[model samples]
Target: MIRHHPDKNLLLEYASGSLPKGASLVVSAHIQMCAECRAQYRTMNTLGGSILESCAPQAVNDKAFHRLMGRIDQAAEPEQQVTPERSKSTEPMLADAPPVVHKLLEKNPPIKWKTIAPALKMCRLKTGQDQYEVSFHRLSCGGKVAEHDHRGYELTLVLYGSFSDSDGVYSPGDFLLREPGDVHRPTVTEDQECLCFSAVQAPVAITGVSGWLLNRLIPFRPG
Candidate 1:
């Protein structure tokens, strides 16, 4: 199981349609597979609906409303029957493909992987001008990600294996949101490799001797 998750604020923004398209897509995909996130999204939706209802309403033409209702009624009817050839053509390809996990492991990502510490691999998936950047991190068994703090908010989603820090142990489908003041040292377990997808606004500020070595080799953008 992968451990990690996106920040609540980010999820709220996504539910309200305020997040960027790319980030929203990622969150939507994650929510599709994560029941916890789905619950959060439902809460956000409820909150948004309340806010919308509190606002003044615009007048609608009576004829327009009637026409819209008629159209909706038509749409509610069952779809026309399909022929065997048409049914086959309309079916989704690779209908059984695993969720976002496979897509995240694309060989040709916009950002290429750069070796960091021994047994650690890092790759940036987006640039900060986009409001957030995603990073793909792979750590071998027993690997350490070095203690670090964030400048802006950081969202981590575990896709494979697990990692632990001061906060707690995170496994697959777990989400974590680290604000500016948060700091952590992620350590992978000895039994399996850990893969994580992180979205951050700034680079990680590394601490300690091991962190210094990692900072030098990782070529990460400074916070």
Candidate 2:
């Protein structure tokens, strides 16, 4: 069972189509995994339509509207399916992630994972947007990332295994939002490795004596 979920306000923002692209992507993935959130989003959409219908009808620019619809139709075309490639060193299957995430993965597969720490590996997924950095993090059994706090906001979805912080443990399908002033060190459970996907608005601010050094040496990057 999933213990965590994005709050109602974020869901409303997503339904209203005002959320930032990367943040919206995270919320969309959560909605797909959680039936409760999906229902909430659908209800919100229905309510929005009713509200719009109640308002006075506005004049339409037919040409502009048709152009927008054409672009949307192109974007909705079915994506070709090809089995994702995997390297022997890769920790988990891309199949483990939500379907929406597949749009970012390369068709060639064998995702390039970087070793940022002894037991930590990272794989970045390009979003073609500058406002947020999107990536996946893998921590080995009993491993933990350095204690740090958010500089902006972070939305992380657990895709495999489990991890724990000061608040509580998170398992697959758990969605966590960390805003500024929030701090935690996540440690993977001893039984298995933990894998998670995240979209962040800014680099984290690591805490501790080595924080400055680590921060300088390993400033977060989209790659």
**Model-by-model lDDT, in order?**
0.62, 0.76
In candidate 2, which residue pairs get closer than 3 Å at backbone N, Cα or C atoms, i.e. clash?
none
lDDT of 2 by residue, 87-201 (tens): 2334454465665666566432557878877778888777766777888888899998999979899999887899999999999889999998899999999999888888988
- The list of candidate 2 runs beyond 4 A from truth reads 60-91, 107-109
lDDT of 2 at 155: 95
The candidate that wins on TM-score is 2
In candidate 1, position 151 carries an lDDT of 73
Please state the error at residue 24 of candidate 1 in Å.
4.0
| Candidate 1 clash pair list | 1-172, 2-171, 2-172, 3-170, 3-171, 3-172, 4-174, 4-175, 5-175, 5-176
